[model samples]
Target: MIIAQQKPIKEIAAMIADCKKVLLAGCQGCVAVCLAGGDKETEILASALRIMRKLEGNPLEAVTYAATRQCDPEYIVPMDDLVKDVDAVISLACGVGVQYVAERYPDKWVVPALDTKFIGGSTVHGVWEEKCGLCGECILHRTGGICPIIRCSKSILNGPCGGSQYGKCEVSKDVDCAWQLIYDRMKALGRLDKMMEIQMPKDWSKSRDGGPRRAVREDVIIE
Candidate 1:
């Protein structure tokens, strides 16, 4: 899932200070799971903004609203009425969600309340680790399910780099060598022979180098 972290209260408050009334919009998707932006978070942020404004003698009016997903046009269309009335919108979702809302509204002042992190999963109750780099190419088949592109410090496609020592990465002692993990996994699975095969250079055109990507299924489209 896409991970995100909330921006500081002071920063968020400063962004909407010019407006007398602002809308705090939250998303119930990825941000909700990360505890950055959700229904409860939106309400709490609205209250905090109100308190801050009140203490400053500005007394700003803030409203809280949540959508099933800010990334989807279907969910965002429902907020048209609420967004049209507010002076500005504080979107408590990922960067993608923020952009989606801005593109949908076009005229409304939309601001992000969270910094989009990366494609990762929760390792523990509060710990989230980066998993995929979204490099436009997936090579998990030969790597024993371990992603060297994301886990390695230097995204080496073949094997461990010279920086690998004692099964740890040269960048940090806490970091394990990605290729080492791949080797062990492959060895355990009796697939070590796969590693001998040389991998071709990644095709950069398929990635962000070309620009924004679009995936469309003709069968799913309704004329």
Candidate 2:
């Protein structure tokens, strides 16, 4: 899931300093699970902003709504009535959600309330770790399900990189050497021979180097 962290209250308040009214839009998607931007978070932010504005004698009229998802047009469509009355919209979703709201309401001022983090999952409560580099390719088959691209500090394709020591990365003792993990996992599975095969350099074009990317499933199109 896409992880995100909320921006500071002061910074968020500054974005709509000139506006008397604003909508706090939240998403019940990835941000909800991560506890950043969800229905409850949206209300919390709105209340905080209202209190701050009241304290400053500016008194903002903050309203809020949580969409099932901000990335999809269908979910955003329901916000039309709410957008008509607000001076600006503060999206409490990821970067994608912010853009979706902006695109849906072209004339309304749209601002992001969260900083989009990486593709990751929680290790425990409140701790999220990045697992995929989103290189636009999958190489897990070659690496025993451990992603060297992201888990490896250096993003090495075939490596313990001469920098591994005591099963830890050279960059930090706290960090595990990704290659070491890969070697151990493969060996345990009796698939150590897979590591001996050289991996080709990643194709840069498959990732961000190629610019904005899109995936379309023709079968899913209603038209």
Candidate 3:
């Protein structure tokens, strides 16, 4: 899932300082799971902003709303009626969700409330760790299910680079060496022979080098 963190309240306030009325839009998706931009979070932010503005004698009117998913057009359509009179909208979703809301309401000013983190999963309450690089290619078949692209500091395909020591990364002792982890995993699985296969250089073109990418299902498309 896409991970994100909410922006500072001061920064958010500055973004819509000129507006008297604004909408705080939240997503009940990944951001919600991460506890950054959910229904509860949206209401909290709105209340905080209202209190702060009121104390300052500006008195902002912040309306809170949430969608099943801000990234989906269908889920964001309901916000149109609520946003019609607001001067700006603060989206509490990832980059995709913010853009979706902006694209759906072209005339309304749309602002992001969260900083999109990465493709990761929650390790514990309030802690998320990146596990994937989303490189548009998959090579877990050879690496014992460990991702070298994201886990390796240098993204080395054939590594335990010279920097590895005591199964830890040179970048930091707290970090595990990606290749070392792979070697150990493969060894335990009796697939150590697979580690000997020289990996070819990764194809960069399959990644974000060109521009935005799209995956279309022709069979599912509506004529």
Q: Which stretches of candidate 1 lie over 4 Å from their true place?
A: none
Candidate 1 lDDT by residue in tens digits, 70-178: 9887898888888887999999989888999999988888999998999999999788989898878787888898898889999878769899999999999999999
Location of the lowest summed lDDT over 10 successive residues in candidate 3: 204-213
Q: Candidate 2: worst 10 consecutive residues by lDDT? A: 193-202
C-alpha positional error of residue 156 in candidate 3 after TM-score superposition, expressed in Å: 1.2
lDDT of 3 by residue, 78-192 (tens): 8888999999999999999999999998998899999999899978888898889888889998999999899999988879889999999999998899899999999999999
- Per-model CA lDDT versus the true structure: 0.90, 0.95, 0.92
> What ranges in model 3 sit over 4 Å off?
none
